[model samples]
Target: MSGPSLYNHFRTKDEILEAVADSVSALVDLSMFEDARDWRTALHEWAVSYRAALRDHPNIVPVLARGPGRRPAALRLADAVYGAMVEAGWPPAQATSVGALMRYFIMGSALGSFAGGFVDDASAYDPADYPHLGQAHLLAEQQEKIDERAFEAGLTALLDGLALQYEQARATT
Candidate 1:
């Protein structure tokens, strides 16, 4: 039923999928430390670009959520990230894991930020019912927080940990 509805509206999933893939691919090429030769710079560039893309096209999250194996663009993006890590001298297995981790973190955080209904201040009520959430909501209002800086910081920390692992592995082998 869903397939026919989707098909009637469009040719195939790939039809819509390709547009997203193309946009993301072009954006990745434009950003992601294209001018820099170092992997650390490339990694930072990739993170910034990924965050910007997610912010620009919050609707694309569902499509990308299908996983790299099922989505050509996602597969290509994953391949590029891992390939860059490998080119930086990390082993293939480590590169693959770290790439996957970075993608998952960025994608998940984007979804959380834009998905709606998750953290709306208007929905916050019954302080005694959900004490912790209510307190956080109050704190958010008090702090006037406008963006997910923590998410970006956590992603950086995760990449830092992966870089450490890469260094250790390189030392051993």
Candidate 2:
């Protein structure tokens, strides 16, 4: 749409951003929580879905990173995740923490493309000055693969660590 067209629909940039963010949030997978899968599985599915939505709409990550705000879809997303976590026997506070930590990880991942940050020019990574970065120049070409792998790695680590904590918490309480 043209600038004037956008202005007619949205009074401010913030409104446009909010609308975009809400649409993205609506695309996130929430049905996983309704399944018989365990909490960890449900969380994995949901997070992957959420990340995919954000990754596809990275431009709105900044708005979403601002938190749920009063957006209906974002609030529903939060409510669903938190509710699933608590239903899995996680303490309410810990569930909140889980939701917060996940938002941090997912939104942070969406906020920046690690692969895109690298300079694609081979000359930029001199072996003499940056021996370890020999392959850095190739990162941009493999942006999607690299970013997806990194996100999965980080997500796995977070989930595994959370599992340990969940076990420990269960044992004590």
Candidate 3:
């Protein structure tokens, strides 16, 4: 209940943060891929799960962005994802890079987004000074749609690109 009591469980603030990060990471449901036929499925499931975890615990995004550190659950999650990629035919280095890329995308997306930040009022923008921003009024109204579509599009593109790379790698060897 008090700071000293917390210290009994966590020696330092960093420890508490790491624990929180691990707990959040633990939320990722890898079981969704129990019957996954390929790496793409595994990775996609991982991305969705991880993204949901980050979104649910946005306050822990900064801590997760700092890498897994010594967190057990985080490390295990990385290992499972990386192993899936490698088993799916990716070279070790490329698999690691894919993990890093996915993390960057997920963590960046989890941060505060400007989805509905635009002013919907017409008077907020001066047409003569900013002709292109004249239609900015529509942005706020469409923020949710825009954010959801953008995230789906970006995630699809990333997965598609990675799939292409995997194909290319398979062709080479």
Best by TM-score: 2
| lDDT per residue as tens, model 1, 1-173 | 56578777668778767667556645554346345467766876787678778767778777666665455556667777877888888888878887777777877776754323344463665667776665444444433143456665786798688778878988998
For residues 65-98, write the lDDT of model 2, one tens digit per residue: 9899999999999999999999999999999999
lDDT of 3 by residue, 1-173 (tens): 88779999988999888999999999988774456568777777788788888878999999999998888889988888788778777899998999899999888877865557788888888988888888888888887677667777889999999888888998999
- Higher-scoring candidate on lDDT, 1 or 2: 2
Order the candidates by TM-score, highest first. Answer: 2, 3, 1
Alpha carbon deviation, residue 147, candidate 2 (Å): 1.1
Candidate numbers sorted by lDDT from highest down: 2, 3, 1
List candidate 1 stretches off by more than 4 Å: 1-10, 29-37, 68-76, 114-123, 131-147
Candidate 3 residue pairs that clash: none
lDDT top scorer = 2
User: What would the TM-scores of all predictions be?
Assistant: 0.71, 0.94, 0.88
Report the alpha-carbon TM-score of model 1 versus the true structure.
0.71
RMSD of each: 4.8, 1.3, 2.0
